[model samples]
Target: MRWLVNHKQRLIITVVFYFVVLLLISMRKNSMYKYSTETYTMYNISSSLVVSDPTGTFRAKLPVSHAFINSVYYYPTSKSLGENAIAFTMAIDHHSNNMGHHTFNVLGYNSTNMIKSVATAQTEGISRCQYTTMMARTNTLSRLEKIEIESNGVSVEVPFKLARYTAPKPVIICISPQFAAEQWQLFVMHVHAANRFGGHLHIYLTSIIESYFELMKEYERQGYITLDYWLRMKFANPRTPYFEPNQNVEWRNQAGAQTDCLLQYKEAAEYIAFFDMDDILFPRDFPTYLEEFNAVLHANPGKNYLFYGRREHEFVKASTLSEFSFTELVQSLRSSQTVKRGKVVVRPEAYNSTWIHNSKHVSFATSVQVSSPTLVHVQLPVDKNGKRNHSRDLWKIEFGPLIEKIREDDIKAIEEDIYR
Candidate 1:
């Protein structure tokens, strides 16, 4: 009994040591495990179409849930309305391949058991082509309901929660004179069409060669071009003109005839979009680009500033005898719109100085440098006939699929315009 009482202090010390060790191990596990609150939006469609959320437009395609008769998307239940609306664009893709009927739907719900609201639209036949469409309530929706879309053999139910809506910012276009004058003219036409249809566009035109001065004057006179500013030097050479600033215009010293001229002007807005003079802008769905831009900006505001368009380039051998042979390029262009691998970093500062060396050439400087939230890069339709009927003698690389969005009611009308 005397020995037991004498060892009581040593026994207590042993127990305390083991408890401290266990506590340290528990702390390490808690630090090692972290849960990300990052959420995403997915479109629940009735048709067998590719749907995705660009909230984080990573180059690698993220896994998306597809809704069959019984399967549905449940992850986006608590996301905000801005994070919930599916950016849907219709296309002619799978027309020749799938050759099946399909319908499109956007659904929202708080949970799998509870049904919210389902926005459904049916698109049928090889006659319907792919174009940009927004999945939103014609009227405001309260709390997420159940969404059901019926098309072809597929019926999809997507459950999404009702979060507050975030309106998209305006699109700012960077236009350089290096693009063909005729193509620029066509671009202006598309810009006008975009402004009238869905969203607003700000055009930044940098005069490189003196040849475009006349065209600029004409555009300005027509109200399509707004002069922001100009620069002048004390000893003006015959080749250069004096710098002038107009309230509607902003100008700077000429950096010579470099391609970076328009890129420098990217600072004019929160999101800078690129379009060659020859690219065509579709009538609607332009707001989706801005919405994607705004979402990225919201997530990584003041962190990054580079944006690039995801496009499919088609190389075709043209017959030297006929300009009409080039019309086939449009078909080649449209076929390339499917999602592909490779990341597009949106660095406005880097994009201004660093040109894409070639397709598939992504360097670290552009990728790692300046930060920008990404926007959706929708592939546009290409004219296959190679008719070369347009102004640039170049085929139309449609830009509308990536930018402008059309009303659901206007989908058929826009498709008819493409055929006409």
Candidate 2:
């Protein structure tokens, strides 16, 4: 303390302070966990409440950087875009920074040298993010071994694996970001439903409450679905302590993740269906989902999207899949169909991006194409304030050999996780 009071010591201390501050700023790239402690003055934590210190992270820089690419892939959309293409997944940014100017350059290289490249097309001022595509000539991407994209100067490179213009699976299922999702029963039910429909589900895994990581891993091993972490945003400065209204918008920003999923499966999966866990796009008259989609396409030619009107109802969740009853679920549906909200099945190549209910852009290729068929939506999740949402009278379903198709072993595969 006496040394600091001296002018020479004071000068030395000032230089050391700024040197340490600059050092910390430079080391921001490598982040470690944030440690914190809480002492309850009112009650003893050991007796009254359980205290668990999560391996939490430091307050990440809001809007990490310009053009944060969630993912990147080579999409040979020659048949759809009339050329070869490389799709850069959505770049989510802060609402303020999203409006800033952005420049993108996409480069492709073979083993030896840089072969070809293109300027990636970026969206204008959007809400939170903008997805871009780099276009090339027909069948030219087959030789590229590496792909790199530069966004406003920051660049990221990925090892490229060239895929054909076509995808193998006819149907791919996608849902928006799953944040703090703890309903293992609902998750198992969704997986069973997708597998039953012959679809591979893809999800942007933001957060899960308990043993779902293990649960998701098992499903991944069984080839039922794919889950990957997204850089989900957080409300740095929130107005309310609950942050209910702005939480999903700030944290999940599901539209960006959904768009990323759509782009990833656009060429890999012949048909992409965006569904929530509770929504069921069951085949009414046909035996399978593909058959039903094809039938609708044949009936309404030139239409690419099939949007089903949905019926809402309260779904009672069971502990096991064996105990779950689709018959009971159907009997609980509201008699009248919902007007604006419904799930949609689409030809992935048909749209550029999607919203919560529908695509961002309106076209003949969207929900307007088919109108007769509908899906059953189960709204079991309560409101933000934890209130039960009621439904109307019940309606009948075709049932149509679906019960017979249920495999007991497959049901048991997912049901095993519920109790664990």
Candidate 2 has its poorest 10 consecutive residues by lDDT at 16-25
Tens-place lDDT digits, model 1, residues 1-420? 011223322111111110000000011123222322443333433331223433313122112111111112222222222323432212112221231323343433345443333433222221222211111121113344565443332344433322212212244444322311223323333444344433333343332223344445555575554433222111111111111111101111111111122232323334444443333333222345455444554566464443343343332333322332223332333223432332332433333222221112224432322122222222222233445335422534433222223344444433333234
Give per-residue CA lDDT, model 2, range 208-313, as digits (tens): 5435567778888877888756553322232111111113233345655666677666667778887876665556566567887888887787788888766554
Cα lDDT for residue 335, candidate 1: 27
Model 1 clash count equals 58
The Cα local distance difference test for each model comes to 0.30, 0.50
Off by over 4 Å in 2: 1-65, 76-78, 81-84, 92-103, 120-142, 151-168, 233-251, 320-337, 362-369, 381-420
What candidate 1 gets wrong by more than 4 Å, as runs, is 1-170, 193-219, 227-268, 279-289, 299-303, 313-333, 337-420
> On a 0 to 1 TM-score scale, where does candidate 2 land against the true structure?
0.62
The top-ranked prediction according to TM-score is: 2
